[model samples]
Target chain A: MKKLFKFEFRKLLHSKSFYIIFGLGLLSIILFMILGRVMSDFVGDSSEMYNATATMLVVLPNSGIASLLGTYLVLFACSDFSQHTIKNIYARGYSRTSVYFIKYLLSLAATLTVAIFYVLFGFVFTLVLGGHVASIASYMWANLALQFLVLVGMHGMFFGVAMICNKTGVGIIVNVVGIELIFTLLNFLMQIAKIEFNILDYYLEMILANLMNSQQLTTAALVRAIVMPIVYAVGFVTAGWFVNRRREV
Target chain B: MKVMIENFQTNNVVETENLTKVYGQKTVLDHVNMHVAKGDIYGFIGKNGAGKTTLMKLLLGMAQPTEGQMKLFSNGNLNAERHRVGALIEAPAFYGNCSAVENMKRFAILAGADDNEINDILQFVGLGDVGKKHVSKFSLGMKQRLGIALAMLGKPELLILDEPINGLDPEGIKEIRDLLLRLNREQGVTVLVSSHLLDELAKITTRYGIINQGRLVEEVSATELMQRCQQKLHVITDQPAVAAKVIKKLSPKAVITANENSIDVVGITVDSAKVTKELVKNEVAVQDITFAADNMEDYFIQRMGGKA
Candidate 1:
């Protein structure tokens, strides 16, 4: 298990696609920060509100989380199937369960790695840009932690999708299409049943999209942020593992 | 010349009992019982989509058999016993963007081979001086060599290769044939290889298993298949007339025909040793003895029931 895990992690670490996605993510961060800075000059906002550090922590994810996360999931989670490398790994005596976990865990690690690099890069760039670092960015640890769970949870949903698709091009198309319709899938169910409850708030996409905006950190919201994402992570992982175990590849 | 028959012990390296695979409504494999002994270059012959790759998948643990059982290294515990097996099924699959060295290193680690084994394996496959060239830049033959290199890792006792010489030139095919022969001769490794080039397979194979439409029609050794395909024995001697008379005496019921220095003995298997002895007694020196064998492709096609 450890050998397979290390091999899987190294595969992504050495891949060109991983680095390309990381560049796109960094570009999204830099572009959003510059755009926010230019708009602040005309909106008459103070420097403290649109500070670089604050943008780094809060806006980094919200700006490009969907596309960036989708691309990562599409490439890493299922590209091996199209390359047929997973068949080689299986022929080498690794079990189906072990391969599944290695891929899933490495996907999680890659998401965290890119997210941390963006945050740190934004922090350093604020200093170089001669912008005052806001104290609120330092105290935004709770929101940051919540957003991390939201990201992981969102990854779990796409991880399942990628596993079932098992083709990179199809995975990309399905992931992009799934993200577009996922928010309203449950709402459609609720409206057809004539139910008044808005179940969309509990979905991974909804929670992640609204994570930094609703910074109340209420007890119910805290439980929802913590419990909902973990459930999706566990639920989707279990489902995907079974799907992989029965597959011929 | 053929392999020494004594080395072929009954210790089966690979055995399948009534194995079957069904995909949807189509039955891909139907009750195949394959036997590969310890020192055999077992050539599995079949046309496209004839369950050659499916059987390989089951042996590699890449797919579950729908019915029946398979044993590797004579052990029923396939997962544990599979560690002793290596394979190159269909095309070589690798991270195309990575260098050949990097790709080999990655699979070597996963296969539990020592890092020191890398250079030796790459050199064995004639890819020693690639110098960090990416696999995506490699030609089809180079990629096939890399795939073979990957299979040679971890000291596998049994190698299962499917269509290994598909894209190679004639020289490359001969090189691979020599490699397999060397491995079987020097290391006593058992090889299960499939190829469309029946002539190449006939040169190296010690045994054959012909499959047609998901059924294993036959499993026979090279010597036995040759005997079944023999047309007549041709003998060369100093005096063809005397040799023909001697061969006629050895097999009276056979038809003997002679040319300037050679005699053809048809319709029977004669004692060539006795004929050689009698020819020497008659002062007609025996030079060479051989049999006109049938084309291996025709024989295999017949074994496959004229399917391909």
Candidate 2:
């Protein structure tokens, strides 16, 4: 077991894709920070509110939060199959279960790292520009962490899709198509079902809106968000491993 | 000179009992019963689509046999043997971004390699110097070498390689050949190498199994195969009628297959020079003369009802 874990981690660390993804995380974090600082309005007493709004808008729309997060996480998860390196991973004698789990953990770690980095830089930028550091810092941290959970969950959903469509090209196409078509389709369905949850538009849109609003997360809401992603991750991972083990390579 | 079956030890490292693999209506492997000795270098030789890879996969537990049983033995317990087997089937693919050393490190860990054994095996396959260099830049031969290095990491008693030298150059092939030999001879590793290169297989293999279409036609020792190929010499002469008369009178057991002017004669013991001299003395024209025992390739062709 120890040997297999070391092997998994070693492969993950040595992969060029891993480095590329990590670098992309860092670059995007910096890009978000710069955007936050430039667009921030520091006028009179309302300067803190303006800075907070600017940071929320920049992070949520472009970097720290929603649509961008989903894309990055999905891309990172699918890159393994895209490059056709899954065979290499399994041929090393590690079980399919272990491979998928390790990849899940690695992607989680990377996403969290990016989330934390973006929040840290956002703090430094806000302070230098004469914004309310204490009032907004906590919100920023909480929002960033919540956003991280959502990103993790979104990754799980994407991972399931990846397994369902094993080919990288198909996975990408499905995700892009899902993003473009699902929102409207879900909205229409929600009206027909008379459901108030508004899940269709809430997937990426709600996450984006919350980032900009600095809305406090209720315990139930937080649990629902966290648990929903876990369900997707576990379900997809099981199916993926099952399909992988049974299919002839 | 066949492999003596009764005298062979019963402690088999790998045994397949009536293994069958079918793809829909077309059977790829039909009831293959293979028993690889604990310390034998079993060479699996066959033409394309001979189910060599399928057999290897079944043995490795990568693919389940459609209908059969495969058992591994270790210390008289089958379960213990599962952890001891190591294999590399098809091409060895690695994460292109990682270095060779890193790839080995990963495989060594998963293969249950000890701390020192990891680096030792890397050096064994000549990938130690490729320390930080990513695997993407490594050539095909290098990847194969690394693959072997990974397979050898745990020092498995059973090593299975399928078409291992597919893309290697002459020097690379020679290097791998020597490495395999040393591993088997010095380390007591039982190897199962499947290849189409008969000459190369004939060099280091201790045992041979010939498969055709989906059935294993023959399984014999290397010594027995070499001996069987030495059955008789073939002679080609310019004058058919005269050469036939001379060969029949000299060696009654000899058979002749003649064309318009060229003739093929088998079963004569005389040297080529002596036979040529005798044919000329008898007024038979000798256009070109060549005599040698049939090789494994020839024997395979003959067994498959094809002239070689």
Candidate 3:
């Protein structure tokens, strides 16, 4: 099992797409850091007033981090077919169960790493920019964790669809069209119906919105946000395993 | 007890009874039956789209047979026995980001290999030096080598390889052929190989089952088929017509077909001295007498009726 994990890690690290996504995220962090420093130099510190203005600037763009995590998920799940490497993995002694879980674990690990860095960098930048850190850390962590779980779970759905289709293109299309566009639209309908369906909302986005503004949100909304994504992640991964095992190679 | 005893007697390494597969209206495999013995290098020979790949896929548990029953190693337990077998269904593809060792390790886990055996298996396939360097950087031949290495992992007793030597240069072909022979002869691994290269397969196979139109036409040991597919000996002599006349009386079953100055005697056991004596007795000045037998290519072409 350790050997299998090691192999999966090595493959993920060595992938050009992995490096590409990481590089893009790293570049964005650097750009934000430079921008924050320049803004602080221009508008002298008003720390005596203890304003939340700088915190807003730093954390608002963390949503871009979510999009970055999303893109990474897309590429990582699709790379098996894009590179035509699934057969190699299948022929090896690892069960399909292990393969499915390993992919999920790697994607989750990646999302967590990026999410943590995004929050940490945003907080440190805001402090240097002469603004109070606020109670954003706890909320940011909560929001990022929810998004990571959801993204990882969504990636599981992508992985499952890819296994069933045995082609990367179909997986990409399903995620882009079905999950991003179609499901998002369905989520809109649920919201408009006023049927008391808060779970279908963009939980990460809502939490990020509350975090940036330092607003006190309802526990019911927060609980729905956290629990729904975990369900998606677990449900998608289980379905993927079942489909992969039963489907002919 | 009678039923249990009957089951024990049918212990073939691979058996398919009336296995059929159809893609829409076209039938790729039509009720094909195959039986391969344990520890046999069963060479599967056929033309393109002859269902060799389909048969291999069925045995490897990659694709379901549309009709009929498929069994492996005396039981219908393909998935349970899959760990004991390794297969390469088509052109071996590997993850570009992984090194040869890393790729092997991933498959080793999937195939259920112990931790200590990964390095040994990599070395067996000549990828021992593949450290840190990703498979993307390896040559095509190297990838194919890694594929075989992965297949040999877990010390799998049964190996199913599809076109194992395809895209390989002459040296590459020889290397793989030697490796396979070693695996079979030294380790007692049973191999089922499918190839369009009949001559190459003829060199190392223990037994061959020729498939045409998705059906097996014949199954015989290589040694048994060698007499019928041996190398042809062409005899060129002065007074070819007179030499042929005398040689005909000696080897009655010999084929007396002529080229320019040579008479071709196919499928016959001929002694050079005996042919010389007979030609001289007929007053035919003997210069040189050559004898030739049918090679594997000739036999394949003749057997396949010159079909592509």
Candidate 4:
């Protein structure tokens, strides 16, 4: 199992697409930043959104991280199936369960690594755009940690979709765009009806939004933050593992 | 059961009893009892969709057996014993975007082989010089060689290769044939190979297992299959050199080769009595003559035709 993990991790690291995904994300950000700079030339940088913390808030979700990360996770997980390389692994005597979980652990590590990089870049861009850092706060650190968890939780969803669908073409569509569209529609409908009691509070997407946008963390928000992502991480991974194990090579 | 397991541990590298696999509404493999003995290049012959890949998949644990038992180099511990096996079933499975060495490195790690073994394996399969080339750009033959390189890792005790030489040129085929022969001869590797090319299979296989419609119809040694499939007449004589001269004079186009004690005449139209008479008329002194099927492809076609 350790060897399997090392080999998979090595493959992931060696993948040019892995770094390309990150580069593309950064390129899009650069282009968007230039547009924002041009727009600010007339408006004169009066807004408070250019600060380090506020820039992170505006860019992390909107920076194409969600979609990019979603697509990358699906691509990574389904490459074994899409390329049929899993046959080699299984033929080498590694159990299906071991392969599934090793891939899961690798995906988890990837999510956390991307999340850290995104946050760091968001801060770096604030300085690039000539904004000052905000005063450090304990609650802010907690919020950042919770948001990273939310990213991982979402990564789990993408991983699950990839494993269950077992093909890059279909899995990427479903996870990166399809599932998010469904959640967005659900949120839209809830608003049109003006329903007070929200069922989506326990969902990762909703929790991620609430954590990213909330000014102060409430007890209910804290509980949802802790419980929802864990559920997504564990629940999705378990489902993916089961589906992958029973799946034919 | 214990006795059978012990017997196979020494005598056979693979033994399966009543091994069956069924899809949603169709049975792909129906109760096959296969045995691949040690040091055997076992040829698994079958037409496409005739369950050759299905049986290979079942042996490698890529698919579950609906009803059966298989022992691989040991008793019941399939996972442990599977460590001694290397298989490449169906189309070459690989990361196309990665270089051959990178892909080899990836699988070699999983296969418990040292990174140093990668160069030697690639060289053996003729991919050593082009190790840095991405597999996507590779021709079908190159990819096939890469697949073989992957299967040859870890010095496995047994190899299960299905149609491994699909897209190779004649020279490539000969190279792979020599490679398989050398591996078997030098390291005592037991190989179970399935190929649509019966003639090519005939060249390297030590024994044969013929499959028709998910059933192993026959298991015979190479010599036995040749004797069974061959229709050429072997004319034993006191002077084989003289017999060859007379046969060449009798028919210029006839493939007549002289053995130490006999002249093998390969042709369907050659009558034994006519050859015997010709050899005797030339004072060649014919002692005996016999005829049988002379082509593996012809025999296989007959077999498959009979099954059909």
List each candidate's DockQ score: 0.53, 0.20, 0.25, 0.59
TM-score, predicted candidate 4 vs. hidden true structure: 0.83
Lowest lDDT sum, 10 consecutive residues, model 3 chain B, at B299-308
Better of 2 and 3 by DockQ: 3
**lDDT tens per residue, model 2, B1-308:** 23554434355777777889998898889888777887889998877888899888766545667897776652333334645666667887666777776666666666677768877877777777776888888889988887777667677887888888888888888888998899888988899898777788778999988887778877889887766666454555566888878877777776666777666666666677777777888988777777767767888776644587
Report the C-alpha lDDT of model 3 over A176-198, residue by residue, as the tens digit.
45555665676778778965664
TM-score (C-alpha, index-matched) for candidate 2 = 0.74
True contacts kept of 4: 0.80
Per-model TM-score versus the true fold: 0.83, 0.74, 0.71, 0.83
User: What is the per-residue lDDT of model 4 for residues A74-185, given as tens digits with 9 covering 90 to 100?
Assistant: 7888888889998888887788998888888887887777667777787788678876787756776777778887887888878888889888889889877797678778
How well does model 2 score by local distance difference test?
Answer: 0.67
Which residue pairs collide in model 4, if any? B229-B293, B230-B292, B230-B293, B230-B294, B231-B292, B231-B293, B231-B294
**Which ten contiguous residues of candidate 3 chain A have the minimum total lDDT?**
A48-57
lDDT (Cα atoms) of all candidates against the true structure: 0.81, 0.67, 0.69, 0.81
Writing each residue's lDDT as its tens digit, candidate 3 over B46-100 gives: 7788888988877765566789887777778666676678887787866776677
Please rank every candidate by DockQ, starting with the best: 4, 1, 3, 2
Name the better of 1 and 2 by DockQ. Answer: 1
Error (Å) of candidate 3 at residue B188 is 0.9
